[model samples]
Target chain A: MEKIPILRMGDFLLVTIQVDMHDRLAMALQDDLTQKISETSARGVLIDISSLEIVDSFIGRMLGNIAAMSRVLDAQTVVVGMRPAVAITLVELGMSLPGVRTALNVDAGMELLRESLNGHEGIRHGSNF
Target chain B: MAVISSETIPVTSEPDIVFVRRRVRETAAQIGLSLVDQTKVVTAASELARNTLIYGGGGAMQLESLNGPRLGVRLTFSDNGPGIPDIQLALRDGFTTGSGLGLGLGGTKRLVNEFAIESKVGQGTKIIITRWK
Candidate 1:
């Protein structure tokens, strides 16, 4: 019954993960995010994990899946505000989230998303699979 | 070596995994583990808890605070599900039976000071990991 809300800002969707997410919640967010992407035709997504203290391989994989899914749906995803400890642990866990983009904070993440959307718009549109 | 405190938590569903992590983190901190060590143990607990639920088909986790020559925390995860067929293969990185990244078992081993596992097909699996302060 508990759900993570997805907020829309112009052509982008912002998700701030404040809670320590469980498996079901992560999966639910995946479904809801992709559906929202399709419905809103969003150009980018920014996931802020500032408040998350722990991120294991499961959550790491979920972030990767979200990035891959967003790419397929013609959107870019930037995961921001990862704690240094979480980053070190993730690398040690052997999950680098290869496809997911990351930034230091929300503002930086938004800038990266906007830059990618505008500069590489033509290339991404043409390389659609 | 003596156990200062111990608690058993059931891992039946997704929310249970989160609870296990929180409890493990608190225990790790109480044992005087450094911030990095706390994160490592907590991350290891999260991985093992999820494995117990998803791969082992639900189980329980036992948390122990140790007071010996050194203070530490020990976690034991046990499941009565269909056991692993090959532990060596399972311990190798990038080998997964489920949709995960296959980092649970191997990575968890690396995060702790002591790691042990016992499993028998059709029986169950039990994993114990300890981190010293």
Candidate 2:
């Protein structure tokens, strides 16, 4: 019944994960994010997880899946505000999250998303020329 | 050493896994584990709890506070579902029989100070892990 809010910022979707997410909620988020990307024609996604203290393999996989799905939907994803402990535990859990970009905070994440989107636009323009 | 306190919580669904991780974090912190250690134990608990629900067909986790020369928290997950046919293979990374990425058992083992698992074809499986402070 509880749902995570997905905020739209320009061409990007911002998700700030403040609660300890259950498995179903995580899966729902993945589905919602991909749908949002398609519906809004968003070019980027930013996931803020500074408030999340623990990230197991399941959540880690969800994050990875969101990134991969976003890529296919013509969007780039940047995860921000990962706690040091969570980062260490995730790596030890053997989830490198290869497809997901990460930043130290929301500001940096937004910047990364902007750069990624702009870079893609540049490539698109270059191809036309 | 003796257990200072203990409690058992059922893991029948997805939300229960989140509850197990929260309880494990609180127990580990209560035992004065460092931030990193608490995170490690809680992360391990999350993975194992999911395994119980998904693979073992639901079970329970017993959380215990240990007292001795070293203070610590111990968690035991028991299930009576269809048992793992090959624990050695199951413990190997990337060897999942399901749709999972197959990091649960092997990665959980690395996050704790002590880990033990036992299973039989029809008898189900039990895993006990401990982290010392």
Candidate 3:
């Protein structure tokens, strides 16, 4: 598998994991995100987990941690491009990531990030919209 | 700020873990929380479930959903297994008493909007975490 890559995109930091599943990558991703969130104080973060095929408990928690860290930094975080298969595992494993925002694709996720930065009030509403 | 709703689920072991995670997400989704919010809630549930299995000696998970304007999910995993003797030690990263990578409590704490932990030597452990939607 390709190594996970972290990139800075404007106001949002994008972290891409090449791993097929959520594994110890959760911890590694957490560390990388925390450092970026702390140093730049970016208003938003987009974790591109599109490459991931599965999400286990550990990776789910790690994603959750990124959201929490972003909150602490006064920045918002969004998880973009998760495969449906991964979502199924997450649901099956009984892991809920309530604090993080997820978008079907990077564009949608980026749009949400912009909305968050624009001070949109209703963004906190559930995922159906 | 206050707990809105709480429920206790008793089941065999791993199977029940999935139930709690789904229920919390469903409730959060019903409240209009975003996908990101659902992920946080579910991730927190997974942590608690794993702990319940590994440390709690297979007991039950107490799930709390806080609503009204700002929504949040609070969950507690209580097991009569071997209690965590040192709360601080257990909270540290890379400190797993089990086969896990040791991200159970610490990672769960990071996943929620609000977090609290309590445990006794022989009794059990109670982890209270709230993730706002």
lDDT per residue, candidate 3, A34-128, as tens digits?
88777865778888888654465667667888898788877788898887745754654446677879999989998988887778444544322
Instruction: Give the alpha-carbon lDDT of every model.
Output: 0.90, 0.89, 0.70
Q: Model 3 scores what on Cα lDDT?
A: 0.70
| Candidate number with the higher DockQ (1 or 3) | 1
Better by TM-score, candidate 2 or 1? 2
lDDT of 1 by residue, B58-81 (tens): 999999999998999999999998
Error of 2 at A12 (Å): 0.7
2 against 3, candidate with superior lDDT: 2
Candidate order by lDDT, highest to lowest?
Answer: 1, 2, 3
DockQ of each: 0.64, 0.75, 0.04
Highest lDDT: which candidate? 1
Candidate 1 docks at the CAPRI level of medium
Model 1, runs deviating above 4 Å: A121-129, B98-104
TM-score of candidate 3 chain B vs. the reference? 0.85
For candidate 2, write residues B1-133 as lDDT tens digits.
Answer: 9999999999999889889988988888888999999999999998889889988889999999999979999999999988988888888876687576457478889899999999988878999999999
Q: Could you tally the backbone clashes for each prediction? A: 0, 0, 25
* Residue B108 displacement in candidate 2 (angstroms): 0.7
Residue A66 C-alpha lDDT in model 3:
83
Q: Could you give candidate 3's per-residue lDDT for residues B1-133 as a string of tens digits?
A: 6666778887346557657766877777776666766765676676677677766778787776676557766677677877888888877754676475345356556656787877888887777776676
**Per-residue lDDT of A1-129 in model 1, one digit per residue for the tens?**
989999999889999998988888998999999999999988899999999998888788889999999999889999999999888888887878899999999999999998888776566444332
TM-score between model 1 and native: 0.94
Candidate 1 Cα RMSD after full superposition onto the native fold (Å): 2.8
